[model samples]
Target: MFDLDRWIEIFQTLSKNKLRTVLSGFTIAFAILLFTLLFGIGNGLKHTFEEQFKGDAQNSIYIRSGRTTKPYKGLQSGRRIQFRNEDSKFMNDKFSEKIQFFSPNIERFNVQAIYKGEQNSYTVRGVYPDYQALEEAVMEQGRFLSVLDIKNKAKVVAIGRLVEKDLYGQLSALGKNITLGGISYKVIGVFSDPGGDNDERFIYTPFTTAQGIYKPNDEVDRYGLTFNPSLSVDQALSFSNLLTKLLKEKHNVDPRDQRAIRVQNYAEGTKNVEQFMGVLNIIILFIGIGTLVAGIIGISNIMVYIVKERTKELGIRKALGATPKSIIGMIMMESIFVTALAGYAGLLLGVFTLNALGDSLEKYFILNPSVETYVVVGATIILIIAGTVAGYIPAKRAARIKPIVALNDE
Candidate 1:
């Protein structure tokens, strides 16, 4: 497939009118560069979203109590709804077969933690064992709370990396005693998270331990639940609705009081995220194509000017028995060489720049870089088509020029 002679001819022709060819090539190259950057950013966003979803069950549903906006079952509007441990137990026992994992969250604020007289203020959580999976925490030392810890209201605690650094400094925190809210708990685990500041500012203990130590009178804040993996989206929605109605009835509240209890469905979140990304991709694609169109127009104009300058040469060739096909092929070769070389250069430059920026760029904007294969392929095809079209009109006009008329013209 390599045609060294033909390529030499293309280079020779390009060298004759260096400025014009360079300008055309620059247009195509700039277009490719702009397109590559847009697509790279789009892909990055997709990657970041995927990573974020990994931290929690994408199909999980969360239930939280809120104030009623409308009167329900003799209760007045503005009444605050509360969910207790009994509600969580009821959901687990009633829907055991439908559920995969479930937990109740009890969180308190501004807990003072002290280790060897050094102190810091952080949020403390009383969480079930499943909180490890729910929050996607990775323990760096010892272990998370076990079932026995919860049952016995053990004094063992798991602290975040931020807490460990503040309390222990460079010293190992495992097996050490730290006083939280004036009650001492043995440090059983130190953990890390992707949740940034929020994760760093929280400590975890067994739910029972936390409740007994902190807010023994307050109800649990929310219920976190994930259904069996085999469940369909529609089925999950229906099942969640049924569970919501049962909970409303049990609490002596009206079923239709949306504000009294809120159910957050990951399936719905997923649908919304998909639709949003779809619209975003369409806009990005249009911008890329629009730039390419401008580049194509530039290429077309340059080819027309080059053809005009070569009118006499083309006429001499025609009189010497050169066919119209040969003339068209020569013009096309020049166009293809210029566009392909510039476009490829632009693509490489864009890719290199993005790769260098990597996670740093992503972290700043809370997005990820994730360019896909199909986009690169699509851009290449567009380059070729634009090149061919740009050359065609000028090539046809040159082929029609009469030898006598072309020679007579200045």
Candidate 2:
């Protein structure tokens, strides 16, 4: 299979027609390059979407009440809807099987926190022990809030990773005393959240303690819960819809009102994201196929032109005892070699460019774009095969041309 003489002939022919060789190579190379870049960028866009949703539990749902914009059933417009402890009991009783984890959230912003000489303003939330799971927080030190802490109305707080960093510095915040709003509390845990810096700056306390201290009348700011993980996205969405409708009815709010009782379901967002990602995958596949098709056409045209230009040379060889098979084989070998080499060069360049453009395209919502080696290599192999097939058509016709006719015509 390793024909040194045949390869030498190919090399001589290629060197003699440098322009033809470069033209053929560039066609395939540019196609592969464009294909690689497009595929990499598509993957990067997917990564961005995944990153955005990674901040929260995929199955979590949040409920927040706001001022109603429309009047309903004798109630005036602009009525402020309030969530309460009774609402928590209502959800647990109504959807016991569908709810996995639930927490009534009462948040305080700009809360002044002091740990010895360190002082900062951080967000403070009052939530049940299940709030940890709802927020998808991981305990970095000590432990998260416990049922016993809530039951005892313990003056214990679980601070965020950044909260500890800002106040306690390198020293551990666990089991230390931290003062918040002129009230002293023992630090029981330090947790980190995937939601990034904003989430990691929060301090959490027992719902009972905060409700008693801040709102003794039993008012809740919002509700956070995760649906049962076994539920499908559609089922989760239905559950949230029913929950929102029921909450609105319980509060005597307008059913058509958008702002009265808002249910923010991650499932709905996930369904939309899945649909988008599906479309994105289809688009990427289309672009890749289109790029490959264009490359094939370009290389095919160039191969035909190369054969046409070498018509006289092929005829002279045939007259000099060159077999038709040898003539076709030489042309095919030359075309395939150039195609494979150029395609690989283009692939490497595209990959290197993606690596160099890493993170720089994040502002464009493209994260660490890259292409798999097998994908690009497969494309290159396909181009080489196309070149060989394309070259064979013209080579076969040239092989049939009579030497006398070819020589007289030229």
Candidate 3:
């Protein structure tokens, strides 16, 4: 199996046509490199898109009030639609089983926040305890708002990381007091949001406290609702539609007026994004496979030319009692050696490029572009099979050469 003479002959044949061999190897290498990079880029794009949805629950919906644009039941066309605390309670009573988490918000924009002598204006909102999970807020230093805080109407506040930096300036913000609009509240938590600095500039307080001190009239600005996780995307959207219709009827808003109530279903958005990414992946796969097929065809054509040029040598070996199997094996071995080396080089270069650029690309949301181990193994197996197939036809032709005819050719 380890024939030194056979190895010497193979090396000698390859060395005779160095330029042609290098060109053949380059074609295979380029194909593999292109495929690996395309696949890596596709994965990076998918990762980036997923990051954009990390700020909220996958099955969440946001409902906000707007002015009615159409007349209904003899009401005027320009009636301002508003949600109240009573509506939130009614929805909880009606859909307790279908709902997972619900939060009613009342917001005051450009509220001045003061800690010690430093003061800055930020958006302040009143929300229930469940708003923490609904907004995907991670506690960096202290605990989030508790249900007890909401029920007791405690004057406690949860500030974001950016707010903590601005007000407290590297000091422990937990258990400290911060004044909002001349009203002092104890800091109970500091949170970080995945949506970056914009989401991290707000302050959260108990809805009851805000309603009591600010609105005092039971007015709600918006509602955040998340359905049971077991529900499908379409089912969740249907439930949201039903809830919207009921709210419109109850508030005397026109059912056909889309402007009266704005509902944003994150699940529906995620589905559309996934569908687009699926099409993108298919396109990349097609291009990669097409390039690889072209390279394999080139290898096959080169093998045919090599065989034709070596006809005289093959015939002389046949006359010296060489068997058809030996001739075929020689040709196949050369093809496999060349393709395997080229494919390996391509794999290494592709992985190295991704690793070198991973850090720089993270700002653009393209992170950790890589191919899996199984994929690399699969590509190698495919290369070996392709090599065998590429040489098969030429190997057969070499085996069929007549010793006398081949030797007589000029």
Candidate 4:
């Protein structure tokens, strides 16, 4: 079955048409290359989003206030609304069983912090002890706010990793004084965040202390609540609905007003991420298939042309007692050889490009590049099928041509 003469003859014919063969092969290679890169970037986007989600409990819910949308029980629209600390207290008292962590957050505007002469402008957050758990903060040095610190309205502060790096220089931050809004506060802890782009350029202090010192207006921006992780997604949903209703009544807004207050549901957010990822993958798959189909069509057209050019040679072989099966075998072998070489070459090129860019991608890109074993296997099978189908029709046409007609034309 492995005829050296037959192989030599096929190679010789292809070599004679070098430019045409290269063009055909290039089509398949580009198809695979584009497919690989698109899918890699899509996966990278999904990975970035998933990393953002990992910064907090997936079952958590966020409640923030915005201006009222509709006239609420005769109150005019365009009124600025505020969520108070008492609202957070009310939730803890009412939903003690459902809620895991409750933190009322208040923001200080454009606070200037100074450490030894280095100055930085950062937002100051007033939070309870549980805020650390909600933010997924890892303490780098010293400790986070203890219960006593929040209870007694101590002036203890926690600095983010970036903040520490900018201010502390070579010295440790613990037990040092950092001035916020011209008031000196002792640094109690230094912290780091897993997600690099997020707002870790701040200082956190006790909510009560912040209310008394900076924001005496007592109007807080938002309240954050995380449910017990052991709770089901449905259970989280139920809690969110209940909290939304309770907050609406407390804020004196119409319960039906969709924009009166915003409650960001983690379950819905997770679902949206999955749906987006699915759409991206479907798009990638279709583009890849389309490219490959074009290449296959090109292969089919070239094979037909090759058959036309070799008519006289096929006729001579047929007259000399070569079977139709042998003729088909010769065509199929050439098709397979071209398909495998081009496809494998394209695959290697894609992998090499990805490897070269992987580190730079990880630093500046939000997406992950992935190539599974099954994907490779699937591509290989698709290439084989494409080659076989392209060869089949032309070989059949050659077998049908009578030896007398083919020889007379030559």
RMSD vs true structure, all candidates = 4.1, 2.7, 2.9, 5.2
Q: In model 3, where do residues sit more than 4 Å from their true spots?
A: 1-9, 319-323, 351-377, 400-410
Alpha-carbon runs more than 4 Å astray in model 2 = 319-321, 359-367, 400-409
lDDT of 2 by residue, 268-335 (tens): 88999899989998999999999999999999899898888888888788889999999998988898
User: Where does candidate 1 stray beyond 4 Å?
Assistant: 1-6, 40-55, 66-80, 212-219, 229-238, 297-301, 304-311, 315-330, 348-374, 389-410
TM-score (all chains, Cα) for each model: 0.80, 0.88, 0.89, 0.72
Instruction: State the number of backbone clashes in model 1.
Output: 4
- Compute the lDDT for candidate 2: 0.92
In model 4, what are the clashing residue pairs, if there are any?
A: 44-367, 44-368, 45-367
Largest lDDT belongs to which candidate? 2
Q: Rate the local accuracy (lDDT) of all candidates.
A: 0.82, 0.92, 0.87, 0.80
- Ordered list by lDDT, greatest first: 2, 3, 1, 4
Query: lDDT by residue for model 1 over 1-410, one digit each (tens)?
Result: 77788778778878888898888888888887888888888877776666666657777888998887877667788888888878877898999999887878888789999999799888988888888876778898999989999899999999998899988999989999999889999999999876665686689999888777665775788878788878877788888899889987887677778878888878777766787789988988898888778877777787788888888888888899888898888888887777788888888887887888787886555365646657765785687688888788888888988888877767
**Candidate 3 C-alpha error for residue 250, in Å:** 0.7
Better model by TM-score: candidate 1 vs candidate 4:
1
Sort order, TM-score high to low: 3, 2, 1, 4
lDDT of 4 by residue, 192-211 (tens): 87656355787899888888
- Find the 10 residues in a row with the least total lDDT in model 4: 365-374
255: Cα error in model 3, Å: 1.2
The TM-score of predicted model 2 comes to 0.88
